[model samples]
Target chain A: MAEKKMGLHTIKLKNPPSILSTATIVGPKEGEGPLKDYFDIVLEDDLFGEKSWEKAESKMLREAVRLAMNKINLSPDQVDYFFAGDLLNQIISSSFAARELGIPFFGLYGACSTLTEAMSLAAMMVDGGFADITIAATSSHFSSAERQFRFPLEHGNQRPPTSQWTVTGAGAVVLGREGKGPYVTYITTGRVVDFGIKDANNMGAAMAPAAADTILRHLKDTGFTAADYDLIMTGDLAKIGREIAADIIKQNGYDITTKFTDAGIEIFDLTTQDVHSGGSGCGCSASVFGGYIYKQLINGNLNRIMIISTGALLSPTSTQQGESIPGIAHAITIERSLEK
Target chain B: MEKRKENEIKNIYQQMVQKKVPQSSLIKDAIFAFVVGGLICDVGQFFMNLFLSFGISKDDVGYYVATVMVFLGAFLTGLGVYDNIGKYAGAGSIVPITGFANSIVSPAMEYKREGYIFGVGSKMFVIAGPILVYGISSSIIVGIIYYLVKVLAR
Candidate 1:
């Protein structure tokens, strides 16, 4: 098992876990976005028939997991492990969802990178003979996040242009030991990197260096260049962080300009959406990957892709107490199996 | 040496962030604040005039105008329109008595989900608490200072 480990922080999976199915559920705002057609469920209202935004967020994750399970006619009992998280205090969205799904759960918190983090862990579990099947899932709600992080939902305050709109969505993916293609091939876990960013509003800028660092490390560890993957997507760096990350990567001898994109940027129409930076939160990458990118893979349009989700680890109290925001990212490489 | 390196790193990253992150348009914000704020004040003035025309005393007119303005702010917030105005209006909508009402009512409304006592009742003053704390305490300090000055002059 030690020999499976790649250089530094990366590992090359011996028996890659194949993604059997995926389910993405998004709010109307995202349903109206560019990749609208890829989502399995587009909620009419954000409430999802729940009284509170927190409950609705949990319901979204629950519904996403059930829907993913239903896609392959798999039951909750069939799922060996459920790894999930969300951008809520105590990760209530995931914990509540776990209680409903009743699959042996591991509640994770890596901020917005939680989905990728879950997937990395789930894939490892499947590959190591620890589990035959595992589920990776996460969610985030705009209203819930705003209340917990910044201000009240109806607070009469202006957001800075650098502020990102948390993508209100949830997504779940089922990874199994047995599947035909689109396997989780490599795992690159990121280290916490802080460049002394104090502003919570401009998280993209804070997380950019971490995103770039992960990408660079993944490439070096695997001895693969940027040209290897069909696409390399960062989680929620949005417009500001995406540019900074790509620039940093280019400066460090790896040119990923053309092949690089971000889940935040692609999930919204930048000009018309009015989401200053772009879409973010845990669901940004989760929904996009489950809805859009997975479709591309299944259709054989994209043979190989690397997804690196960036996260800004900071609480309101931490920012209030004058602490710099630390950022982390996790990269998961999924490739279509070349076997006939 | 470690602190110096940390500071150097902080300085370089701050520079990059400043360059990349889009700045709020001060000119646009100023204009929006001015127009919206002026419009709100105009409504207050209109109410004051109408109340005075009804043979109400000048001393009582001020009370009526203030009450009406505060009511309007709370009302707009309930209708979910004040935040829309605040989004673009910035200080225009936020500086007025209406903004103060908004500051109180918005949290109460948001925390309604948590329950009436803990959520709405307790958190309602979360945002407005600081204003009251400083505003009233400062006035008391001024009052004591005024009294001392009067005593000293006598």
Candidate 2:
């Protein structure tokens, strides 16, 4: 008989990886969010005393990684691999940080979804016994992303209401085979889904469908319903994308409206922040997960939670060529350690 | 068969995505543009009057006014005040000669670190290149047409 798999896309790890420690660093805007208290450091200046935004982002990521390691009483040399990514072209932020950290590095490119993508890979490495300890991290800066993806900041183009603000922050999580924390139980890798969304400004709409698809597939594969998990979080969907995702999932017979929340929406006080559609970036979900979600799990306030980090795979060249944005969402299920 | 399944999925996804497209307020944007644009024009007219008062010839006043406006626009862009105005005024800041000055200087300022030839020089005309090309080409075409008409009439 063939070994049974968990649905079509899910993987049930034989050795569950535990989240040893996590750290988050955010900009002034993100620091003003509801979960501000949970983050490790909140910089008053987005530049973090750096000359350029790109360098600032790299510095933030390095600091987050160091903080996470410090919390676990481990140094950079002790960590097996550093899995990191960012929204910048060629992921220079992560690459430059990796060079500084001097660890076995695996740079990822998942746009806004990079957090969960890195975590999923890190979990797999720990579970598969490939490595004992690994760090998963990602960062995004508003100034850097704005110039790279859209017009220059000085252009003063009126941002449409559909546009989501990129969170200027970084989050890092350390995963290991043994730890007194939440266990990464399962992972569901997603497929790139394109809905023919041509507007580059409205990233939430482009990535929402992928979030819904991954959520539905994850539920099916894991043989779990909406009620089974305390929370079902989608990364960077913000306000507009969250509603669209909820509707799509409901149409497929999964009504997770009450339990569903989004990192983008949760990161900011929408009314006070004036962040039109809310926050959307690799760091949006990463910081929220590392700071808020992990804390809740460790405190026993929540049990099982599934995070589906959504990414829009579009380059400047691709958008200029009039190609529709393709989105992907990677899901990871984390549960409070029963032994603890 | 595979292609058909993919298309079906694509159609459903597209329908769902279309529902979430945020609506833009046409009236508010128009009001901003109108007020901003009008104010910029008023500034230009003020400059024209100022030049005429200084005893500049009527024919030369237009050139001097344009020079002043362009210089002001570039200067404001460098000082970072123009961006704030742009934020509030929307098209008001962009639809005028100041906007043109902003377009060129902003990119040049941004790419200055990459060195003169590759960074600033190459990217300097990114936003204004097309406008220059079309503007010059159309003027030449109009000149040729006018010459042909004059010759034919004679």
Candidate 3:
């Protein structure tokens, strides 16, 4: 007997329109009243100060998770599992944050790509029936990251043109059974690629090749072309990185033209701002995905989208050892709704 | 529940503000390092913006910025400022372009006593070489496509 062909069992979002509740906590904008109704918690602390950044970052993550759970009408106990990570030493911020959330947690690290990685995993878990609800989150504070990874914010250091402004914020998103919102339909994971560039300051160029590599894989795996989605976005590959990614894609015989954009470059109005290329940090993608794109989804301006979060896997020790900067990118296909 | 975390933070803050390590006070050192490091980046940005105003294309900005940063980083390393910054700010001094330069050169300089070819010369470009290679290659490939588009569009 021929087996009946069932419709695609990919994690499909149920409602055609998905509402996003977002919270942004930047050092400059801390202490402000509620960013929005759905967003309830906002913590004010600088990670780079002589104070304890990990502690503050942990609290921020907890706050973001708490708000996300409340906004989604889910209890912390009800969130079957927590998938989270951050740009902290040993991902301690994520681990600690998850501890407070009190959910079964799986800690992940993809540098700035942590949010998308969380989303991809959470979607699969929900789709596989391992969990009915999950939360994906990430946080990065410029001061804290700088002190731990670079120079202190008060230091009179110079940044390279390829540098990105690591953002100071944490964002969370809750995923559930395809009821109402964007569904993670497919994912393409990329192998790390290093073209021997070791300048951590110039991360965009270091990470672009990986972005190009994964986007190509994504199109191939899903049998979808650039036209399949209205927008194709890459995470944290700022201005220079985006240009490099575009060039690589063009060389590979696919031209994204003006339609393709990178979140790092798009997040800020560069002309009016000194954030040379654009924003970086785990929050760079997390906030853009949760705050900006999620809104567009609810507005029905976007139906299908492919988001590839690119990460530069460089550490202080590796940079010191003269090792090349290797990059990894993860892509997730999102549809407007899961239900037919 | 939140009060415990807040109290913990207060204790850490008090310790950081009051205590001095062997070389200097932790808070003083950290603050000094951060200020100096930030000023360096501010100056770099100023000049970079200046070059852009002088009509330098964005394509060449990275190399120029890198060169200037290398000089400053090497100078800081020589003055022992970077080391002090490291003691205080920890990762702060190491995360910027200058820090990257220090990472590349300090090792190469240490290895110079061993030999030039395997040590200084070869190791000098350890951190930035592959990125340049890939970047240049990708740019050239893209440039060729742009040329083709220009001709084909006509």
Candidate 4:
């Protein structure tokens, strides 16, 4: 009744929330990647002097959140809500980081799709007149994810070709009621889609269907073709998933092949990086969008972008129990505010 | 009727995924495994010869050779060299006694953060524990069969 809903699954905000500031931090491996200069902080070591990988991941999330707020001279008390998530069990990284910030927290677990989950929800809160300023943050450390999801650090096991390297990083975005430019205009909440994919190594394959479903629905709702947006970025779809998603989207009558780009494929050089397929995890999309794409928007290098972050919701126990992975994707349209 | 259509789509999607995924060559992997695994065994044989030459009894040489190989595996794992070797060698590295050593030592090194007692001591056998349990139990069964056969012969 308040705002005109675009169709099923699409939210058209009456008042758009502005992206006030963004900060990104990554480990040495990601810093060595192509988007090295974009990140605010490049950790020389993965551990960052923590005794355990979990602690290190928590520290990175905290630092990125603080840096985002500090850039605009806003304190933790100023931010009305905190939306944070990570790949760790119980999302310990976000929970621990949230403890230190003393902000009201909404702990999320959308797997690799946490960034958009945080962003879209934060935008909703800001547009609804509930809060003035909000922060959306997520983190994923390679070692932490490995121990929690795969194997111990020293465990000698070969990664399958389908496997992706989790980006060791964290990203934070501070959103406000009014700002200069780069406003969160629309959110397309994803529905859970499962092709009953069982192989966790092929996460890109598992999530590709959801990525296609969300993008197709968003386009159908908004009545906009793929040509309308400058870029349509999917989070951590990597090589195989990106291809499969593109194929599926085209089959559904919306051809986004030209405009489509995946944060997973963009974050690392596939041939040389030894990241078999490409970079993945929540931080893959988070670090890419929060650091690189945000800068491009500010510089007017890009006009409009639809970021559809995908998640393959499979826990270690579920995978062991032969439960199929259910994939989800959430999308947000961030546009450059029209200049006067 | 709706469920059947969903099943059809899922089947089509699965096939597409299989095509897109890069296939690993089994023959190529096997070659690497044969070479690297053979080298590890050669080193074990060398140790056996070395221990025998050192005036250690033939009976004691097997024990000494095993200790040396296990020590080497643990040392390389600690230095973070074995993981790299294991990557290329695949089962070549994993099929040997050194692999057994790696199975035990790797988890111990990783879990050291949780502390020596609960972390290292308990998790040390996590990978190799099932093997030891089954291996010993099977041997007891085999030993009892031999005892019965000897008694029957008498």
Candidate 5:
């Protein structure tokens, strides 16, 4: 007989407010809809130049961290540790910012699922007695990323409708000792899953199956149905990936029709931004979660939310190998506790 | 006197290095670098789009884009754009074909003096040859698979 490998853990957020504030950073303007109050930070001020690339990223990251700290009224020194990273090289933008903040920091890189990875790690630290308060953050800049990942702005490459836009911004969150709000109760890390896809433009299609695998595993491990939580969130698996994830979940007979949502999908609803399915990058969730969702949490608009941040674990070497994309996802549960 | 002379020389070298690249605020410098780099690309893209709108065919877009990209890549590689973008975007530049173009041409250009046959010719295909092979092979395989699927469905 095969023993069950899935494990489950739970935590209750104290003084769980109904609504949490959420913020979104985009090219030059602040984002609207379900995000205004959740976060008050904007990248428009620091965003400059024909493409400030590294300068833009480092600036946005600092602003995002500053915003999250401000919203929660916590200083950098008071925070136990700063957890952050990005899709950039050596995750320098994150490390560099953390250095300046002078907070004890732990850097991480999870491609797109960075927000969830940071959240899960911060949750563990808070729950494990390692620290009482920790901040999780992530960022990606479009100009900087495009020049780095694809063509320079001058290359004039056209994007297909299936392609997802990487947003330019950063997001941060301060997770304190359980009594302040809903704390992360459980987390499930996903293995790298691939479907032999090589089209770099269509990431959602490549990442959907990975999302499904993890969601199913999370439900199995927790012995809970989709209806157990108010929302089920996937990080950055844009439109195509969301459809694939939904199909996979439905195929498994654990339907999440009413509740399933994606950070990448929702954030890109503003067409003026030209992002087909919304924004991607670790900052998609970090800023949205810290800015928009946190506001709703504090306002008592939403009580329990399960955030499943998703990541794609593809490197330049692997992509160049003609190998398919291997995606990884992580799920962290946040909800209100009775005692607080 | 000998030790003092060596020390003075070292001090002059340090001063020269500092003058070449001043140490500013890390966060400010990084942010400035990222934003400026991004804007330059934006301008380049705008011009590319304008050029494409002038009736330059799609397939040839690569040719046009390549000229600009090669120049930019060369400059960046020269001014250290590749390394900076690498720090910021990770696999950002290299993931694109332009990156492939840079990877092939830059090293070849640098080592052309080593003999065109051993250096330029050999190294030219080092980064991109396999991609072309895979691209062609996959198309064939995919075509076969499609045919099978269509026949089976019928």
Candidate 6:
């Protein structure tokens, strides 16, 4: 019989797909941040020699995909599938990058949760014997996101303290069916949760509950406690959301304060960076996982980790039309082999 | 039954979300707006004095000073400096004639990619359109009332 489905949303892969190589490229602000050394490329100029911020983002994603492929010594043509997404309208950055790559592409949109969503799908394809190797990638640019979601950079609009800076970067990971590396074991998909939050500036508050809900459901479905993993990372929830998520999770009978860390808070030093809340965006988690988390896993510094990336799914039109922001979180568990 | 269940879930979610929303300080925001707005007006006043010293008639000084200020605003917006000022100063940067200049130039620049006529020209008034409509309409109405009162008095 087929492998047992533990819970409604959880997927347990029988032959877990291994992450072969990963790459990250970040803009100057992100490069200056605490995780600067972890990134593969820290661009001096955000434009990256491109005419527009949108083009620059596409270039960053393409370069990340190339860099990841180079690390694995495999060409783009060898990869079976390419999954990518970004925060831009129609996800132009990913689609444009895919045009240059000339691969079988599946464009995804999960806002900041794109990384975990892409990773989960890529792992499923590899584990189900549908593909040998696949690549999951996502990107975001500060200027591009500002113009699309908030105000034009030229507006000089004041940002509230709760507002998080969109990290300007791209991250890519190559997953293979057979590899001696960190294995993706399980994935838990989250439902859309809207708590009547209408302020687009305060995304942390909007997405925190979804993060908590997913983490709780994943633990129950997989029969794993918070203590089971060395680290439990949430994508781009920043400081405020992280605290709220912790509170909700604690009330649900799981306390992950000691094990929990957020990509938004980890990417930037809140005290010094002037990023009022923390780093955020599709790139926030993507770059963090590719640059820092993956390195720790490969180096054996961390044995098991659960990444729960959260997203605030609000469009410019929706926000303007007085619609509350809906949030979603997707979780993936990756583990290192004991024998290795 | 399904509709009721959905409403129940939404209510629970709303309560949870309400508890987490960050408190925004009105006093702090107002102070930022006041200071920034005041500073912009000061710059306009400085320009007015400079124009007056140029020996232009006092009657013409108002027009010249306003023209200079508007030009400066547009120029700075093009250079991408005005936006930075707007960010920190918030409403302060926006309350002045300079902010009006920024509002026009910003959308024009953004839509420049779509071509001059369709993109830049069409979108130029996106932010300022409503303000212009009301401003001109109100002045016309006031003018009509003054004219009617004068005719009736005579």
Best by lDDT: 1
User: In terms of docking quality, how is candidate 6 classified?
Assistant: medium
Model with the higher DockQ, candidate 3 or 6: 6
The clash count of every prediction, one per candidate, is: 0, 0, 41, 0, 69, 3
Candidate 3 TM-score to native: 0.64
Instruction: Check candidate 6 and list the clashing pairs.
Output: A156-B86, A156-B87, B37-B92
lDDT of 3 by residue, A140-241 (tens): 877668756775333334454456787767788887774566666666766787665566877877787788888876665556677778888898888877
Interface RMSD of each: 1.0, 1.9, 18.0, 1.1, 20.8, 2.3
Q: Compared with the true structure, what per-residue lDDT tens digits does model 6 show for residues B1-154? A: 9978877877886676566666667787778879878887888889888887888888888888788878988999999999888877778888688888888889888777668999788988888888899989999999999999999999
The digit string of per-residue lDDT tens for model 1 on A171-235 reads 99999999987999999998999999988989999999999999999999999997788999998
Best candidate, TM-score = 1
Candidate 4 segments whose C-alpha is farther than 4 A from its true place = A338-340, B141-154
- Model 6 misplaced stretches (Cα beyond 4 Å): A1-4, A338-340, B1-25, B53-59, B140-154
Instruction: For residues A139-195, write the lDDT of model 4, one tens digit per residue.
Output: 999998987787776666778899999999999999999998699998999989999
Candidate 6: residue B22 Cα off by (Å): 4.2
Off by over 4 Å in 5: A1-26, A29-38, A45-51, A270-272, B1-154
Give a tens-digit lDDT track for model 3, residues B1-154. Answer: 7978765744552343223111224576567667867877897898799889989999998788788888988787766576556544554676677876776656565445447888678756654566568979999999999999999999
Which has the higher DockQ value, candidate number 1 or candidate number 3? Answer: 1
Report the poorest 10 consecutive residues by lDDT, candidate 4 chain A.
Answer: A1-10
| Model 1 interface Cα RMSD in Å | 1.0
* lDDT (10s digit) by residue, model 2, range A1-340: 2242488888887788899999999999999989999999999999899978899999999999999999979988889999999999899999999999998999999999899999999999998889999999999999899878876666656778888999999999999999876999889998998888888878888888899999999888877899988999999988988998899899999999999999999999998987889999999999999999999999999999999999999999999999999999999999997553
Clashes of 1: 0
Instruction: Please report how far candidate 4 places residue B119 from its true position, in Å.
Output: 1.6
Model 3 / residue A25 / CA error / Å: 3.6
TM-score of 1: 0.98
TM-score, every prediction: 0.98, 0.95, 0.64, 0.96, 0.65, 0.93
TM-score of chain A, predicted model 2, versus the true chain A, to 2 decimals: 0.98
Candidate 5 CAPRI level: incorrect
